[model samples]
Target chain A: MQNKITIKNLNAWFGAKQVLHDIDIGIEKNGITAIIGPSGCGKSTFIRCLNRMHEVVPYAKASGKVLVDDRDIYDSDIDPVEIRRRIGMVFQKPNPFPTMSIRDNVVAGLKLGGLKDKKILDTMTEESLKKAALWDEVKNDLNKSGVSLSGGQQQRLCIARALAVEPEVILFDEPCSALDPISTSKIEDLMLELKEKYTIVIVTHNMQQAARVSDHTAFFLYGKLIEFGETDQIFKKPKEKSTEDYIIGRFG
Target chain B: MDRLKLSFFRSSRSKLSGDFIFEAVVGLFALGILILAFLLFRELFIESGLSRKTFGLSFLFTSTWDPVNEIFGALPFIFGTLVSSFLALLIAVPFSLGIAIYLSELAPEKLRTPLSFIIELLAAIPSVIIGLWGIFILAPFIRDYLAPPLSTYLGFLPLFQGPMYGLSMLTGGVILAIMVIPITSSVSREVIMTVPTHQREAALALGATGWETTRIAVLPYSRSGIFGAVILGFGRAIGETMAVTMVIGNSPRISESLFSPSYTMASVIANEFVEATSKLYVSSLIEIGFLLLVISVIINVAARILVWKLLKVEGGKVA
Candidate 1:
């Protein structure tokens, strides 16, 4: 598979403490790649670096190369806003714009980009919600406040919102960690369907989730990439002892 | 062991009684506020009975104030109070929102604390000292520098016409705007800060610029709160006495021009309360006080309802 994203010698810091050491990983196009690690292992920080979101925190900094489509996103001339548009993110907790209606929340990104044509917005909202598996549930209540939905529905609504912008890549930073098992299974199914058309990267601490949904898996420990291989290989025959220990529930 | 258990039971019983006493004391203090408000209203209503009976509803519209003849009307003072408070809001709202946005979103870490401290300090300065500064500094500044250009360019409008006086409604409004800014901005800053980090990230991840993120995410989330802050400023402006009385010229007349001297209800009360000799004259002044109190209560209730409605419609969930 062709690599959609290439990272080289990436490092990140929050104030004085470095969280991500020199890292290199290539994300394949049209496939789900999972980054698995214990808490505080910099898994979330690593994915945030992909879309330049790590730097949104005060005093947080990142250095190195993040290239999409063979062009460096970190180039001095590149706009971070433009990069972010091409690389969308869905956070761990669902955050639908509280003040907006279901229809408005779905089209928020398009409206922000000055797309005011009503017909197009309506069509896009429907299509994105359908893709997120939320259209059937929320179609009748399109005008309701975004937060009026159940937690699982809210997460799906957030996914639809991310999809509205039609980004080339979508990042999920432990998107289902706050969800129930049924919701988690639904999101896992959605990721499988989504990978057919978009590059997908997920950061999760759930090793079983990684084993179940990912085509490729990277295991991180103490800010280091301990192992990376095919999902079957990583689970069945990890090359590194630390990866084996972690996979077998020896120690996180 | 039996003695120890008995003591424990006794202590527990005493603690329950203490809790009840504490609750009753707090409840009484809360009730005291309502009682005090009612008493104030009763006193104003009874004392202003003569004016209310003599002039009836026409008193609010008639614009004549003659102490010697015992004739009075609240029109000019009402007009002046409303106009000056609204004008203060017009000038202060933009600057306050700008200051709040900068402090909450754009200010560097090192600058945020000191800038916030300075704004709070501005709010703490005595109104009497502000009145003195208004007389010496703000009045002259408006007369010499601000009013000339406004009348010269926008002179066709009645608001900017007439000769510029150092002491006028314009000066009063400007002084009120200065006094209102710190409170409005600080409250707005706090409201803006309450917007969760995830909301901003949602906007940013959608390819929005910093300004766009604030416009879409931060401002909308804090709309009701900012409105409440504006209302708070209006409350302060309407009731402000010392600074406004010193700069408003204390004239009992209405004119189209902001450059003309005018009187506000609070200013008139502060200026004439002690000197009011006739029973009718004092009653009329007290009636104006009654009107001011009623207007303030109405405004506060309306603002609370509006904020509450906005929050309810949005489900009151930031996450």
Candidate 2:
């Protein structure tokens, strides 16, 4: 139950418009934390700020501190590239490198770091795919284009790609919203399994999904953290009125 | 009920005829292009019949380009076109690709649009003006400074051993390279932009540097398209006439040096077409035109085959 990430007074801006207000939350080690909110409530933006992905957009900026394992990730001395390697992100859509083979896609991160050892790459690709529950399906056709897979399988492939880097924390930006129910169930099961090894944070519009998979849930409303607590307490006995209204199918 | 069915049947019949007329008009418009190409080929062949009959295929092998004797061979012009265009591609491809990458990946938001527009504006200058500039500035600069050092240091090479004339194949190639940069860079920028955000995200999320993301994810996805852009620039460089004619010295010879004056098929046609008095002279020029047509066809067909082969090698992705 030790904290892995500590957010302190973070605010994000896209051009002149502020998208996230002052926010503070701590993500614990080896557990899934879900951020549930209405559309445009800054849930995704909040997570993106954790990995410094928000600043990639033109005119987008952020201020304040996000510390991972007691080290300030926002310090000027730290390289964003190094931070990203340690904290991987999986996008909502299945975004396998279209031109790369299944094996190449999994090992893309390793290649970027100049790891060209063929035996190590082969072993890592297999291990990562197995961890993401995709090895059995794609092992035979390792040379096939990453885009050739079914949508559900493509999502799994993307997960394997994220896993290939062996990150400390993995961010899922609504990873299963575009998936079917069966795929959703599989991903949910995978996340539950993944939390045993790595810190996980998910931004979800599905309250049920947050309730089903998260150990800690943070409810956001109008760029504010309305409630943050254990999932059971948040769902059964939220201290905030907004959290209760939102979880009970009241107004978003 | 019978009356309603009769009206419905009549309407559908008229709709079918309407669709047929629309389809036929578009089809005929497409057919016009083929017909025009065939007609142009026929005219060139018919007009060049004298040279074709006299020299047969040996016209391509011979280097004699005497107008008075009614003897002409396209070897020099062919060599000029290939060498100049090859050099142009060699110079332009890397330079333009750098510009393309800067625009696509590295340029700051405020600077990106204006810089790209300015780069594209280079294409708008008339080729005649470029040729004039080449004659006045580039030629003198090369003769006085660049060529001397090259010849002094690299005299062992035949290409550098020749006397430096300001107006030579090098000048023409450099001019062609300047002329072709805009098309390749702009098209390459367009190709690079087609790489989806998700693809970029996938790479960047893995802790890749900006350069690595662009190199591993963006470039590989758009490699074929960038190649196509280069080929398009090559097409422009090979067939270029006015600027090349003015600067190429209009001499038909096969020389080992870039400092030597040479001729290209298009340049020869442009320079002598009006003054060509003899039937055989016109025939030879027309035959050169035919040769140029054949060369372009071969290049395009080769590109098509290469693209197909790439697609087959990489599964179903676009080449």
Every model's DockQ, to 2 decimals? 0.71, 0.56
Instruction: Provide the TM-score for each candidate, comma-separated.
Output: 0.92, 0.90
What is the total number of backbone clashes in candidate 1? 0
User: In model 2, what lDDT does residue B252 have?
Assistant: 93
Residue-level lDDT of model 1, residues B62-144, one tens digit each, is 99999888889999999999999999999999999999999999999999999999998998989999999999999999999
Error of 1 at A28 (Å): 1.1
Instruction: Grade the docking of candidate 2.
Output: medium
- Native contacts conserved, per model: 0.74, 0.76
In angstroms, the error of model 1 at A36 is: 1.1
Best by lDDT: 1
